[model samples]
Target: MTSSVRGAQLARLLGQWHALPGRHRRPDYAALAAAVRGLLSDGRLPLGVRLPAERELAEALGISRTTVSAAYRALRETAHLTSRRGAGSWTTLPQGHRVATSGLWAAGDDGDVIDLGVAASPAPDELIGAARAAADDLPRYLGSAGYHPTGLVELREAVADDYTARGVATSAEQILITAGTQQALDLVLRLSVPAGAPVLVESPTYPNALAALSARRARISTHGLDAATGWDGELLLGALRQGRPRVAYVIPEFQNPTGHLMDAALRERLVATAHTAGTELIVDESFVDLSLDGAEMPPPVAVFDRHSRVVSIGGMSKAYWGGLRIGWVRASAPLVQRLAAIRVGVDMASPVLEQLVAVRLLAQAPQIVAARRAQLRGRRDALLGALRDHLPEWTVTVPAGGVMLWAELDGPISSALSRAAEDVGVRLAPGPRFGLDGTLERFLRLPFALDEETLTEAVKRIASVRYDLDRGARPTWRAPAVIA
Candidate 1:
């Protein structure tokens, strides 16, 4: 059965909805249909969510039931909504339109396609040994209840010690192990910020973070990052001072997509400014250990935070393996307690075996970091060379670290290119997925985490599609033969 949204809740969510910004003198029904369609297209209204009944929604919005019925009819005709006699209408994107319009993409199921959308690599050989070791230690924990909301004590201590080694004095009480960085972010946002509160985020930031903030119905304010200069301190400070957001989500070290590392001085200033503005800063440092230059990096932002306003999230996804699914949040002890309580309602606790494996993996962090650095550096160089050779018109920055490159295309056809590339055995995330609203259409994120051969072949296919798009060829939208 499909979950249903209450009329009051749906009305609250639709409070910010407005007609599309155009000069067309459309009827009220068409305008309302377009507004809801925009929400569905951008994922604000998730698929399978049953909308409020026409009469109920009309009453809530102070509109006539006839208008609401017409709007529903329009949405139904366009396949954005499906209705049953007594069950009311539910939100959904037309089958073929889901992927491209939703701004999310994945590889094909057949193993014959290259997916440049996600910047993830395979787990290292050490994972097997770690898992085996964890199994050997599992018997000891069977004597007691395994539920640990705050995470295994051994893993917490390891994470705390890891922070201490990095120049930040931390204790186990200040750390809460999470399923992954994503969960850490979700927990923090839910506990610290209320719905409709203003939240600051970097433009063209991680798409998943944006989606999380959107899910909370937060008022998002963006501070743009310069591809050449990285983060703009003044602009960020101005937004903090003016917007006075309740939270600011940022990726400080080797930021996603762009891979721009925040300098130490600016990092300190940003934290101080946020403290003065009463903004809680959530810093994601998942890629901090993947520096390709092997240079000594700046300390974590938590080191510069004196007011307990910054919460740093660290994960093994990028450094070691995404499958590890282990991450931690370093904050004040009280904040950690609050997040743990909130997490109880979410997942109850992270898996015990994964926590055990994480402990062993933490012991071998130096080796893992070094290996990932070498592997990603080689792939980065290879992808750069391929792009320069095949798609010369696209301008891209050579990121010093991180697994992806944010490249600006010669034309604003990222969405079209992504749709067409799928037909040629390649899947790409359109640029607009990384930004708020429908911005960043002229850019694309190209991940180099795959094998060199796969990267080469993917780039070849992308180049062919790019050429076709440049020649005025449009994509023919159809359901994929296979979904992965």
Candidate 2:
């Protein structure tokens, strides 16, 4: 089951390959090789995916075949690519090279390193008491076989009740708990999206969702997002009607990276358009509970779904803690059954103790979320101030909620910035990682989930890296202690 990228697609992913930061205007084979290597390191170009042929890529990129050949040859020599005579070339990692796809490894291995790759924070203080309560509650279920694919009843009721409080009347039967939002998305995609089906997503949506769509071989359609303002209503409606995708994944509330919240009017129109297009909606509400601006939150998109066409996915990772590993999907009861049936074949059920902890956490969510928001507000401001002090040239959009800030750099050097930042003990989530086809190179997503002091230090290091990169000096690369 080898996935082969088309020449046009590869060209799109290699957007502005010639005009990389500190590189000359004229594209050389060395620059091309470096670009591909950067893609591989950042998990953009997954290993083992067959690359387009040199001639085909050359035609698509409007370059000579000789340059493409030399680039491919350089990649092959570095063990970043493998080739057979007729089967074509495929991407691969070098034998001893270790790339931290998630920044946790680098942070754990090096104390000085700051991981801005993930936008999650540590657990709230309420979690410790909840864990103790969960421990006490766990023994009651020990005698049974312990298999609840639709999730534990108490937790489901809690989630459904939370939705109900948010204006969507949800029943316990409509909830299916999974490991996290990622797992819930996977379950929904597994049951809903078929191979080669058209799937609409936001241009700079969640990168992992894009990876899942790619793995499913879905035909992806994207509508661009404005970080300052949310979605353009007319553009999105037009895309829905034209694309007519089988499924559309959207993050209406405090969207990841870009924290723009969707207004209720847009929600109604978008859901109406989806119904007219006969497309199902997968609404991600992972950041729903993290409103920092004190604005009254808009109603969940499900409020506009008259036909149960919208499936809402949420989790405890962002507002609660990533360690909880608790997330659930809110859909029609029948759809929940189908998703649960599919999920049973995959992982049976979420761990009971964790679900118990989530139930307790939900009961105390009000206090936890308020404190979390206050903490995040300070961190967000601190990060903003640091950015202003360290790098005044970059433009940043102030998000109403969510844990990360979307920034526009002065140049299309996000990938280069990431490469250089590693030397300064900082791991960054570059702009292109959130985009499709190597787009958004002029942007970056800086998470404010860390403490104010840490955020200040990370911004300082990043500013230093940016300075070195702008001066056309490459930072000295040092190997991280951890290989995994």
lDDT of 2 by residue, 2-21 (tens): 98899898888888878887
lDDT of each: 0.82, 0.88
Candidate 2 has an lDDT of 0.88
**List of clashing residue pairs for candidate 1:** none
lDDT of 1 by residue, 1-484 (tens): 7888877776664543342232135577876776566455445457899999888988888889999999899888877799989777898766655444333333343376577877888998899999999999999899878999999999999999988998999999999999999999999999987899999999889989988898899999899988767888888899999999999999988888788988889888999999999999999998888889777788889888999999999888988888889999999999999999999999999999999999998899889778888999999999999999999999998888888898998876666577667678787877767887565767888988998888988999999988775454522334545644
Q: What is residue 131's positional error in candidate 2, in angstroms?
A: 1.3
* TM-score of candidate 1 against the unseen true structure: 0.83
Among these predictions, the greatest lDDT belongs to: 2
